[model samples]
Target: MLTLRDYDNSDIEALLALANNKLVSRFLVYTFPYPYTRADAEWWISAGVKAEGDVTKVIEYNGQFAGSVGIARKTGWRDHLAEIGYWLGEPYWGNGIATQAVQQMTDYAFSDLKLQKLYALILAPNTVSMRVVEKCEYELEGVLKREVFKDGQYYDVHRFAKVLKI
Candidate 1:
């Protein structure tokens, strides 16, 4: 079973194990360092501790840290929109775990936070991640050209969003 919860200090080690993989990091927008360290994990938890509102969350599978997911709200006309980002451990990939975690988080963002919409930007060539977003019911809004730079190259991203009916 999959669950979404607040991040805790003890999760650092396991979280680092899941996040440090180069294969996992490649699909994500953010670039994790080559050797992800405990200190890196500690620094992340420190920031998570300060995160409030639509900010941070951890994915738990059977009481252990499985991965992480969070949202950041946009400004100006994008105020009501919050962009979500997530990644799972390489060992836990291909299961419905991410789908369940994202579904629960999106529900909370809609019903609890009163967010108008939740969205994600998936890099082109990451077919697996694109499928994950589709399974979550996040429709592809459009393709963003040269929107993000990763691995010293600019990649086009597919924009996806789901407006809440609630």
Candidate 2:
């Protein structure tokens, strides 16, 4: 079963290992330096445990530290909306982990938090992550052409969202 809990300091090693992998970093906004270090995990875990209520955690499969799924509430004009972001360990890909995790997270976002909209800006070539969003019932809003510059080149994003009527 998938569980969304707060980050525990003990998970530092596993979290860093997952976050710094080449395959995992490919779709993320920032790429971590090679040779994922223990200190990296320590810093991440320390902050994650204290991230207030805006961020959330998920343990994949059986203790794989699977990945994190977060909702950053937009301020100002987009205050009613939240931006969703998530990633999984490379070795844990091909499973329905991400789909299940995001679905569970969004359900709470809509009902518990009373959020109007939740969105994801998927990297252009990340088909697997896109498919996960699709399976979870998030519709493709549009393509944000040249929206992000990552790994030295600009990439287009297929914006996806699931809106909950208030």
The lDDT per prediction is 0.83, 0.81
**Model 1 lDDT tens row, 40-61:** 7898888844555456788888
Worst 10 residues of 2 by lDDT: 47-56
Regions of model 1 farther than 4 Å from truth: none
Q: Which candidate comes out best when scored by TM-score?
A: 1
Clashing pairs in model 1?
none
Q: Mind sharing the TM-score for model 2?
A: 0.90
Q: How does model 2 fare in lDDT?
A: 0.81
Writing each residue's lDDT as its tens digit, candidate 2 over 37-106 gives 8877786667643554476675556755788887878777787789888888887788898899999889
TM-score quality measure for candidate 1: 0.92
Clashing pairs in 2: none
Per candidate, the number of residue pairs that clash is 0, 0
